[model samples]
Target: MTEKPVLDSRAKVIIAACEMIGENPASTLSVRTVAARAGVSMGSLRHHFPTQRALRDAVLRTIYDVATSDDEVIYDRSVAPRERLVHCLRQILAPQVGDEARRAWTTVFDAFIATEPTDETRAAYLTMAAEGTRRMEHWLTVLDEEGALVPGDVRQHANFLNAVVNGVSIERALPTETSVLERETATLYQAVDAVLRAVDQ
Candidate 1:
């Protein structure tokens, strides 16, 4: 039988590079920088990613994985769809009484917007966004089948709600008063709740 290759090493490099990029995307990222953080040599980094563009793209993909993941949550099917939807939106926002989490999210997201990469990178970003939206849509569909949303275009609404949640994080990055944060948070939750109710009704 063929031997299993060392998969974990390359993954470690990507994960570390991703965290670094998450910390700061607008700053110039060098292979040496990522390698040093990953505890791998520049040659090792180059071995996985031949070009800076490729490495950056990989980092983008990894960034998506690091953020907005369902992996950390324990999904309980016993929960109602409406409840599940609310929980998911809350997780996506990941807001605290203070805005530290939202600020961190803004840093990574701004970097994603600034990073110049290949067509594949752009496509990958779009694809990941679509996938998250689709997950919401899937949840909506289930609710509908179970006779739970008002029902029109579930996917469109899901995307809209996801955009709303994303915008809330981006907006929180701005220097704003606590009142503003409160207004934005309420708006986000209301928008999500509205879609859920509309689709189910």
Candidate 2:
């Protein structure tokens, strides 16, 4: 029989925070909530994470790791660069579609927009946004190394792509007379083509 894996206090705390964030990205990860969730004492949680920011950052790092754990396609040179890049961008937008997207936006509005946000709330939201921009930059850098991207600042390109994706994601959550998938695809390719060099180039 296989032995059960062991998790220390720190790991358990992080896991608990990640689960809370997964359930509601905008939810406040208070020490009390996480400690109860992790089945650890408040002292044990504080011993590992000290401050709310520390806990929040640790949880986000774990999430980033999990999200990129299967990102082999980011470096796969076999696929055409434009196609590969578009596919990667689509993954960012995929989660922001349909009723789920509407719910997500509603949560964000309720948490951060509808009222004044606390320092912790503001910091958490900004950190999440910064993490997203970094991921886009990582993808663009790979294409740049392959000589498949236009000559430009990687950050600028990443920001532009991120902005386009954000706009499309917001649109996806709104009511529309027709399905926007095709339009979204066209818009993504247009953004990709602007940054990526032609295949023959």
TM-score of each: 0.58, 0.87
lDDT of each prediction vs. the true structure?
0.65, 0.85
What is the number of backbone collisions in each predicted candidate, taken in the order shown?
Answer: 8, 0
Off by over 4 Å in 2: 1-4
Tens digits of per-residue lDDT for model 2, 116-139: 998878988987878888888988
**Cα lDDT of model 1 by residue, 127-171, tens digit:** 556656756676667666765665678887887887887777666
Candidate 2 TM-score, true structure as reference: 0.87
Candidate 1 segments whose C-alpha is farther than 4 A from its true place: 1-7, 25-78, 95-128, 131-147, 179-185, 197-201
